[model samples]
Target: MNVETITKTLNSLDQLQRNTAIQSDLFSIEQTSDLTVAAALVKTLENLGVRYAFGLFGGGITPFIASLEQSSIEVLQFRHEAGAAFAAIESYFASGHPVVVFSTTGPGITNALTGLFAARWEGAKVIFVSPCTSATQRGRWAFQETSQYTMSNTGIFTSGTLFHYATTVECNSELSEIARRLALGVGKLGGFVAHISIPRTIQTSLLTTPLPHVNFSPTLVTAGEDTISKCLQLLCEAPFAIWVGFGAKDAALEIRQLAERTGAAVMSSARGKGIFPEDHPQFVGVTGFGGQNSVLKYMQEQRPLRVLVLGTKLGEFTSFWNPVMVPSRGFVHVDIDPEVPGAAYPYAETFSVQSDIGAFVRAILKYFPEISRSSSVLPLPRPEREVIKSHLEGLVRPEFLMDAIQRVIVENSDAIIMTEAGNSFAWGTNILRFAAPGRYRVSTGFGSMGHAGTGILGAALARNRKAVAILGDGAMLMNNEITTAVKHKIPAVWIVLNDARYNMCDQGMNMEGFHNVDAEIPSPDFVMIARGMGADGIRVSRECDLEAALEKALALTIPFVVDVIIDPTRPAPIGSRINSLIFHGK
Candidate 1:
């Protein structure tokens, strides 16, 4: 053999060895041109700490999903696209990391929209990936067509109300910029929802250059020194009350300190429960939606001169924008979103401060005088701790059920407690008291029916611990991922409030003076359904069995369900919601 032939043979041997190594080892994102666009994107997401991908796979997205399987990222196939999207959102909260939601063409894209909207409203970092029709196939009556000719590109493929950042990848060159944008988005303050739609052809195309290396430096939006000083001055001007929201959850410790230091009464939004210890001496009550009457009583009897609002919009659900919630002087509102400070009650006086809730609270803590730590001497209003004992042989009352949960789940296990919208939300928010943050979650913003029911799987899988969801029968029937949980062996528990009707609607109609609304649903045996899905379950008809069933569910390693036959006649603590509706109509 000649010298040229010998050199060519050596290069071919090196290439074969490299290919063999690649096949034997796990997939790596070391800037290799040998990777397909889909593989490159998957690797980039893994680098950015995306550990899970939730979706319903289809032919169009097979390449991306397949790439995910090759990497360390766990790809979870859900029963429905919406369930997958909801799961993605909760996983981020449970794990404190970004997650991915993938879908295929047309119907798949539309199916995931509701959950994606919830993800945005609840403030979660979710990266959505989908496959659209190729350029050549556009408008050719292609199956499940997803192109400009067949669908609107305005919001789905572009950044708008639906997505914080969005784009469609038509070529290999866009991968670098796309990766960079994703890194920056997930690292930005608050929620960042992004969409990257790739054509079927580009997913399989080989990369020309290595994907760019990007660093995620999460930007903490803290108030400047001048802003902090102004906030200090306003806070000290009078006796102020601290209004906590879900946004201020990270500042739980600091909020407690501040509240104690200033002798300020602490109250939380419906979704903001547990951010401040509900049993604290200074805690007044929860506000809005399924709020307690204690809050209104506190506002009426001992109204603060100025309210210090932390990380809440004070929207209709949080405040009802009721004049009662308004302080005598005004509000000193601080939130990451600059617009939220005065938007709820624009006519009212507000000293708006835009900053991260936790950081801002820490700043305020430092400026407090040492003497203020002993200032909590005045009498304060406390939330009503109504106790109702379980009967020996009657249907399970919602209050009795909540009491059982507070003992069996809330105090016993570290499981994250979630409540679905409607009566379950009403009961949970009104009754269940938590002492710490991150132990409770409720979607009051979008208030989607099936979020908690479906989201529990993701929460369990991401946290690698038990996550329990309390939902009504309608929500359980609407959307759930029990089979998915069984498939993944995720430790999730569902506590179903089986009332055989849409109780919230049923009760609300009666309160509204409307008669005989068709809100009833034929109750299915949720235990049987769970068994069919390869999970264990228990049905509780009498209130006496409630705690035992909950304990059994929590002790099990597999996904479990506890179905309590709730009494439909018993009204939920939704008087506030009914009153709000009455006010809105007027």
Candidate 2:
């Protein structure tokens, strides 16, 4: 669509929002607690029902920060701008509420892009609010000169954060316009819609007039009668498989019922991790990374007739939009945001229905095929556990450690798990068992290192629960915010998959006979480091030592780290694109 068309749709949507009364008088901004611009922003957020706010607020956002303290909203202050933003993203994904990240100009705004990238890829509906050099600084290379729209659609994390649907809120003269826009776009758009490019002058300068009150409670998008009928007919006609992602939260039960009703095996992106109970017999487990061979094999053999994607971009980590596994045979994608259908997975011969995935699935259940929800779940029969276990152990110690994590988490009633990048990521995705919501935090999109340590801190802090972060040895040393873990008093458990090498890079080079150089890391004794950093640390070299260390780590109320050392030689299967990039030099 052209820019004019975009604006037209936005205006119409804005008008629609204003006509709809807010669910409560709670959404009004007629407050006496110092009506600063920041305060106005805070009120707007409260209207949106923002449960958690994370980010560093030093200069520009102080008024909002102080107001937050006075109000019921809990602010999670991070050590760095990026950390704070990432944490906000974490909060958004965990809870289906908007997370607020406040940052100053220049360095603060620049640092936050990575976190926003993570949010966009993970399909988080978060706002990254940063101050632009005030109105006075335009035309001058003042501190941080950014176009809000650019930040929103940087497309760094995933391609889903596309350019066409981006919006930038520049004028406070349009505060009501902005609020209504946020209500319509943020919740309805599905991915990230940043409220950015806030002119510094406008933020600090007193408002010349009262902020306009505009109501913006969203009307849940629903499928039209004809569309619903056509969708049901399409499903009934095909060998359909359901693929759910982060957007699948609301549609979990509906998707499950649909899967049962159609006899379609359920598949999910890593971000959608536990939407379908992993233990469910029909759940084919997560796709991408070193996902499941059994699941992949099942897809290959059954050759599903229709690939039903609800609330997922079906991103590259799902194999760069591969057609071999999921062909373009009547792919049905249901998303609340229209942008998702237009941008990602456009080549799947798709039918993009504009409605919320969960709501759509719920509505469609009445018409779908009938399958069983309770005919006894058949667990993939233990694949000769002892034989496979012995082979895995003999190939590399890392596999057994991976095996142990799966076993332990499966045993634990409620486990919150985090995995850092590199080989351990492959292992974690392959092994982790999620029990409930807010259970896992792995960087499937960015896969950046040093994330698991601090990221787990965010997860644990958000839930105030115990979670194990399995970090590869090399990745753990990047950002030693072990101090944050100590400071927050978060019960963040770190299980270091210690190979002392960038195993993925090393293995890639080795396969190509290119003399795997500089890939090895100095195997550090993390136990001593953790102790030095005031965190409890333990080491496990033998397989038997694994259970004891995990038990000890979980027993502690404070942060704990377990360094599980393994040989660097073992190969953890990675994607073909990474293979092409590393081996074939593509």
Candidate 3:
């Protein structure tokens, strides 16, 4: 590999470093050969600290694949290109490491769209590279040939900003400079950054390289001084409710301080589970359909004077914009994007400002004068909590079952937890907390099923952490990637919540008075499936068996699966069941 010098300035790197699981001190601005662009891409990938790339092998990525097979980085080839991309994204979300993806020129890029889009929604640092038809084939109906800037034009779709043709770089000479610009985008833009290209004739044939260290000047188009001052003034005067979105990641510290100082209640969307620790007294729980049951009850009674949403998109799942589910008062949307506020609630009397989340919160703390405010009253009693706890205990046995899972991880200092999203996510997120980095990861944005199996695989490879996948049976079936896990010797604890049905869908069906035809599933002995996949597994019907099994599995240096039968009839305690039920035609 040829050592290449770096160029370009990226402000996004700082925020990216903290916000991302993939932290990097060095990245290369590599140049490629006619035959060596593939090798160079792999070299650049190594510089980025990537251990794996997801996607199928095709003409454009042939060289990259061949070299990867011989190198340390392993290529995960999946049945569908989408799954591969999702695996890459899930890995990033689960392990916080940057992932790479490859595709052929056209169809490959198309298949990669969903996975890449998922990363954008959930904030994963993904790099997608594709081979294009040669430059000579430009307009003459060559395979997969289009305008040079097509992909770049669409690149900024998830970027939260308007993008034009200029966003894309043409040919190889411009590749490194473009790669540098996009690389800086990891944190600032907080999504997958693409360095798409075609053949050798296009990439290596070009000659100009842009400045590697060019800084992107950030302008807060949405927030002005007046908006900031008014927001701080409102926050200073009242006991506000703290609602965070996945986007609120940049304001983590500020959100924590607000909750600590004002005795404010903190609640986040399911996607924002880790924004604040559930153990914090100020922390209430999740906010929507799948949120912690206690949170909704508390919000109704408190009627916090203002709800400060930091760096969040407060969408359907979080608010449903339902008056009963959210804080019933003025909502202050603190986002970098100017247009997202009040979009979820049309009738809402809202105060919104567009600014960098952390920066604005800092301004508020530093510039706003403190004022006394009454505490927001806590809402309903532990009615749902005691009930759900009862149901969980009765069905699963032993109140310590979930607690034991946490304790086991605590015992294994090297443990890394990865969960598949579902009702299980609420239980998983509520149970675990991260003290150090690279400990817990999940891909909640794409919210794809079948991703857990592959996600755990990717996380194990990228971080080499002792990864565990807590998944619903429905989610596990999404991709039988256990074979990949076993094949790679990337062992992770796979905990399957076996209910013999899609609980979420079943519950929704019950609301509609429809026969629950499609939801019921044949309960699979997940252990047998694991053994078939060349991994060890255990089926625990009794709660007492779970603790010892997890301990034994963790001790094993290979991937293991645990299938725990859970009662599907249980409803999570917290929000009104009517909201979720209504979707079922009730």
User: Which candidate has the highest lDDT of all?
Assistant: 1
Candidate 1 lDDT tens digits, 60-150: 9999988999999989999898999889988999888999999999999999999999999999999999999999989898999999998
Instruction: Please state the error at residue 366 of candidate 3 in Å.
Output: 2.7
Pairs that collide in candidate 2 are 134-200, 134-201, 239-305
Model 3 scores a TM of: 0.77
Best by TM-score: 1
Ranking by lDDT: 1, 2, 3
* Count of clashes in candidate 1: 0
Q: Is candidate 1 or candidate 2 better by lDDT?
A: 1
| Tens digit of per-residue lDDT, candidate 2, span 168-261 | 4355555666666566545554555464546555665454445555454556667665566567667666567788777777667777777777
Report the Cα lDDT for residue 421, model 2: 75
Runs of candidate 2 exceeding 4 Å displacement: 1-34, 57-64, 132-174, 197-204, 211-214, 327-330, 339-348, 369-396, 435-438, 575-586
Whose lDDT is higher: candidate 1's or candidate 3's? 1
Every candidate's lDDT: 0.88, 0.65, 0.62
Candidate 1 has a TM-score of 0.94
- Span of ten consecutive residues with least summed lDDT in model 3: 1-10
Candidate order (TM-score): 1, 2, 3
Residue-wise C-alpha lDDT for candidate 3, range 297-385, written one tens digit per residue: 67666667788887667676566566765455678887766678888776887887766677666655544334355466443222133
